[model samples]
Target: MTTPDKPLIMLVGMGDLSARVLTLLLGHDATSRVVLAGRDAETARRRGNLALFTAANLGRHADIRSVGLDLRNVAATAETLARVRPDIIFMGASLQSWRVITQLPKPVFDELDEAQLGPWLPMHLTLNHLLMRAVRDSGTGARVVNAAFPDAVGPVLDKVGLAPTVGIGNVANIVPALTHGAAHLLGAPVEEVELRLVAQHYFSHYVPRFGDAGEGAYHLDVRVAGAPAAVDHHRLFAQLDNRLKRLGGIDGQLLTASSAVRVLHGMAADSGVRAHTPAPGGLPGGYPVRIRRDGAELDLPEGLTVERAVRINEDCQRADGIERIDDDATVHFTERESAVMNRLLGYDCTSVKLGDCPHWADELARKYGEFAARFDT
Candidate 1:
């Protein structure tokens, strides 16, 4: 039984991950409903960890339900939408995309029609298309959150005119992590160190992997008291940034899952406080998200840096390839992503291009699909 007045969140993936998110959401309030969705509801239900999220948390009125949904099929997705009429929709389907894109022969050079990497782009686009339709039909202003790479997906979704209300993870998660580290390096409270960062998807995704992200190459500035001061983190983060840069061959599922959990915490607490988050509605950029208590709609704060970050986020994400970060000499994206895209989508690298992508768009999508198809658990 629902609390009647409780907020309803419809989740696309009902695994331990989604269960974790639901558990976090419940911590904030008992008057909440969570509808776990997937192709195999029974499997999701039997996954004791996830099922226990609702069974133990809500007592009698704890609203947790399982439903069958094949998001790849637009109509089926729309059908799920019609039935739930939820207050919020969190799309983690792209997590599967991440898994898929990671598995290909990396930069697949040869492009074949069936083996094309770009075909998978349609998977995301179509799912979003159907979801948007469902939102429109449901007549609910349910905020939509994309739980995947924002830089690429955000822009792609924006282009298709179905950008989500916002994107989770990406640079948003990095901000806090870096901020925390900065505070320690500066020998100040965790809240004292502030990051006025202008970055793209690669900065967030590959920063830790490369172990030496941007370094002097990655542009960043730290402030101690509103204005810029010579903080030790300025140099320390640079070193750590490089150390944390994305590594070519490394397991990232755990990292990705941790980031997902952070996203859940930030979004679930939106009703209670002001916090940081990546831009919503797939704005193709970064922005300070002030989640409106009334409907959880995020907005930019008043300031030059915040505005500029938002602008930079959009520009880098929208460019033809490797967009200039606010006219600074810093590289916003790399050919690596493009090559990955091309191999993933099986598309001609030349035909597919993004401002920051190192390879073709279609190729990446196909690779993304192939990577996702093989996940056993």
Candidate 2:
């Protein structure tokens, strides 16, 4: 039912996360168009058919199509963006798999702590950076929604002036879970509970591993029925994790997809809807965001300064093993992360310079391949 004048949403990456987003969008709004683009047009088509069929079964219809695209090629990617001129671009392409990496041979992965997470930042940003570059070259004013490692990746791209409009998933995923917990504790409806969080990617792992005992200064304010709720943040996070075992990893495609869809719906409607999301306007970590037709802005709750929220997230990055991303695009991994990578892959990459991402990405891919093969049995 989409007409020529309706906005076109181009979704890159036909991975599981993108598929989930596509399915949800199709069912929710049949009047908009979606183009599923990836390296494999055939595969994208297959997925598109499934999404369409799912929509049909649900008594919904959508105008959806597929296109083949390779984001790694700068010129080709730019050409596609120029040709499409989409109003919105949802980037879900990534060289690494969340499932494969997270579930690496238990022994090898166990040796590395959260502070060692920075070494993989290059792999997460490669395609995302390329797509952002393509957007710049195309001269199209399309809003971008990055679906890959936004907590760490978004800031890197932002430093280079290529950050996406907003990133999907991350801290936003925790809001609803926490809201539900508060609602249950207060005996209030979920709709009546409002939770605002100021944190980063590390909290996603921290809550799952230690729950309330998780170390970090994350800002959490919960309100029920227009009054402050007296729920303990730690206990609420623990309750959330206990309620859902799939808070982390690719199993979270459900929450991530739904979060992105909410943003898209807000964008399409041009309403300044507020939602919790990671890296809105390309700042580090996550915050409450106000999405409107003009742009997305951080909506940090009362009593929190932008500087303070940023400091909180920056400090938590160490928990993920990343020291900092320099203005020159050099990503300095925590010493522990670098050592772990050196011991595991024999690759001595202490820091990843912006232009050298492809080399490090290739090396990491090779190392990860070997790691996966060894554990295949």
**How many clashes (backbone N, Cα, C below 3 Å) per candidate?**
62, 1
The lDDT of model 2 is 0.80
The model with the greatest TM-score is 2
Give the best candidate by lDDT.
Answer: 2
Candidate 1, superposed: residue stretches over 4 Å from native: 1-5, 30-32, 48-50, 53-61, 100-123, 159-161, 211-229, 232-234, 239-272, 294-307, 318-346, 349-377
- The C-alpha TM-scores of every prediction are 0.69, 0.93
**Residue 32 in candidate 2, Cα distance off native in Å:** 3.1
lDDT of 1 by residue, 7-126 (tens): 577777764445555555554453246777787888655643454555575663345677888764656666667777766677766423534434444343222212222223334444
| Candidate 2 Cα deviation (angstroms), residue 207 | 0.5
Minimal lDDT window, size 10, model 2: 108-117
